[model samples]
Target: MESLQKSLLVTGGAGFIGANFVHYWLNTYPNDKVTVLDALTYAGNKENLASLEGSSNFKFVHGNICDQDLVEQLLQSGEINTIVHFAAESHVDRSITGPDEFIETNIIGTYSLLKAAKKVWLDIPKEQGRQALEHRFHHVSTDEVYGTLELRDPAFTEDTAYAPNSPYSASKAASDHLVRAYHHTYGLEVTTSNCSNNYGPYHFPEKLIPLIVTNILHDKPLPIYGDGKQVRDWLYVEDHARGIDLVLNKGRVGENYNIGGHNEWHNIDIVKLICQLMDQAFENDKTLIEKYPLAILARQAKSEELITYVTDRAGHDRRYAIDAEKSFTELGYRPQESFETGIRKTIEWYLDNDSWWRSLIK
Candidate 1:
């Protein structure tokens, strides 16, 4: 990828995928600049971006994306020409527990950003508009937009219709439509990527992989919904970040790309794998490595000891797979990390970064 010189606005840069993408781009291009606009919600973690604190090229604006005045001020300013928005309430469980926040942030916030950009990009004064950029609004989205698939169903591609099952996904679908509308009616240069499940460092503890890891570390029972047969295409955080970079820099305008690792696993099986990996991480300890590492688990363990089945989430998607061939072919994208490599690294990150997530539980 050729390095481009530009300043970009990132909403929700404090969250997992957004933060990872922010770090990825800044490190890849030294001359480029990034100004982050985050609302600092419960899921947003400012501590994750603490390393970029005083950099000349990085600026953190502590505010909500839904605030039209703030969003308009920044867009109409002279610095930014590109935007990668990832600031949505992403947790399905939390969306179930309380959905009002999701509607407020995901739908309303996205609408405000679009309207602000349309106004400034098209109607601003020449003095301000001369600073206008070949702007692109890259919306980072999820595979849940296509809803679920049957066991033998083909993977979801860019053309898949929206059939979101959860409130979180439903709200994302609405936002996705808004992005598309901005492109068609207002001619906003935009792209959308609906990706599979992502797991990696800096992830909030409320998520599945981190939740399991934290609970396992605390010797708590790892909870699984239903029989745990729900399947998902697991993509690494870094790989997902790279995909976003490709879409923003190289993908065609008004296009939607589906991103995934092509690695699929049953939920129950993944849990067992984590348990076995935890045992391996605990290997040097004198307590239990001898018995578990007797075999490096190719699949997860059946340790009835740690598995606990809970009530299934209402409207849970049975399976989600992504046919990411377009991104792979057109954008020259391939997952840099395999599931095995990614999962091990994810486990290591949790082990190393205890202090960050420990605060969340408090």
Candidate 2:
């Protein structure tokens, strides 16, 4: 059977998960067209999608999702039928320090995109020669929206109540509500996926996994928050893309799906794992010592010595776990990468692509 061609407007496509999703979609469906709209913010890196610039099926637009007019123009002109909304102010630390950006980008920006989607896809009257295309608005959200879970609490499911404590998560919760409202009130075709923590290549250095890897190479102290007992579910970025692909293709509208890796680890454990991996990498390949001369601890197979505990952030969630059973049973979705396999690939990527991350660090 011939595949259905999708023209996707991927907001925040220059960011970590967004860029990975763009690559996955284009590579999986070669005939489809993808237009990335990004503001190139501190977290948004164009180099993430640099390789696809010349591809006829790929286009990148440096812009913000808050610009409703611009989004509408792209939707109408490109005849975009699917909108993968990944744009947001995602960092919890940043949200705690400066909540205004999170509110603007996460809440208002999502509102803007929804309005634009509604206008172009629902409000506009189809003109002559215009194809009567079916439209879908897929909102990509985080499991944090379900708030922190207690040690004995069950993993968050599609029915989980919203109790966001952080500004970042609160804003995302609002956006998820808005997406659902648009679908119910105005009859916009929509699907939402709330995913657990994602880690992989091109991840910004500010995030945990990347931070540990990069700081190790720089021979800097690895900061652990509080007791580092905070538990989080980690999903590989490619697996996240695969979950989203299933949602876009097989998911039902007006429904929400949870995508998780089922791999839960304490923050401190993850740090130690990365440190062990680094030490092993350096011991196995003597040349890594030369490449990362500053990683003195890693060279001696003692990277864990750099671990340092810092004061915890305000309103830090104790745990977040996703029960992806709904997505698994309904859409036949399952994460392909085990944390063991994924972390190795992530470490190798960082080691191989020093230039890509060095630019961001400095």
Candidate 3:
């Protein structure tokens, strides 16, 4: 396959997974022009992309995906034939507390982008008697849209029925449906990937892995909900980026791919693993003890002592696993990191980058 020099408009490029994707794209294809549009929400931190500010091929735009006019302007101005849509309200807890933002951002915001892309990439080109621009609107989504699974239940495939339980997942499901509609009804070139849980550098500390690593450093309680038996398939953020790259380069339009790490673990087991890793880190480095005096438990090689059981929240999904055979066979997508390697990398990131995650803590 011929490699195409891409001009990409990456929405939500300042957030955790999004920021990592931007970094991966720029590093892998230095010549490609990449533009990021982000709202700088609580979860969206511009600091995540601070290093990329000096890159000649990178541009960051402060804007909301809900602004159709702004999205249209950007698509036209950059001649962005590829849009990597990553903007969405993704937290399940936040969705339960307030679902309005999820619906507005995940559903309506997606609609806004689709409208803008249709106009600039398709409608206007036809109106001006120009050749149709080769374009792809690749929507990044989560496997949570498939809802929970039983212990013995089959993992979620691209063909899994939608059974979202939380407002966040429901909104994402709606947006996924809209993306499919655009492709089938209007002939818009589009692809969607439902990815497993992503963890790595730049991940907001609110999520499980980072939260435990951070809490361990602060000597704070490691809260486990409902015995922490809930299972999830973990995907490294960079691996997810690689999967999307394959999709853009060679995937079939109107198809949905599942990107997974192929590594599943219980929530409690994950927390325990981090505690063990933290203990090892502190043991290996005496400076960690002096640098983070509050990490007394980790220093003592007893971080698990801080573990505290808590009542689980309502509508908590039991297990989520993704079957990525389709993505693997069709797009040559496979996660490069296993849970052991990925989690260790994640812990080291938090240990070395205190300045980054510390600023986010209120």
Better of 2 and 3 by TM-score: 3
What clash count does candidate 1 reach?
3
* Candidate 1 segments whose C-alpha is farther than 4 A from its true place: 1-4, 125-132, 285-304
Q: Residue by residue across 241-298, what tens digits does model 3's lDDT show?
A: 9999999998998999999987899999989989999999999999998889999999
TM-score of each: 0.92, 0.97, 0.99
Q: If both were scored by TM-score, which would come out higher, candidate 1 or candidate 2?
A: 2
Model 1, span 1-362: residue lDDT tens:
13557778999998898899889989987778898999888988898899999999888999999899998888767457888999999999899999999999999999998988887776564446474446878898899989999999999988888899999999999999999999999788889999999999898988888887777766567799998999999999999999988898899999999989999999998988888887666754444334223322311333336678999989889999999999999999999999999999998888778778888963
Q: Candidate 3 — what's its lDDT?
A: 0.93
Instruction: Report clashes for each candidate as comma-separated counts.
Output: 3, 0, 0
lDDT of each: 0.86, 0.93, 0.93
Please tell me which model should have the higher lDDT, number 1 or number 3: 3
Q: Quick one: best TM-score, which candidate?
A: 3
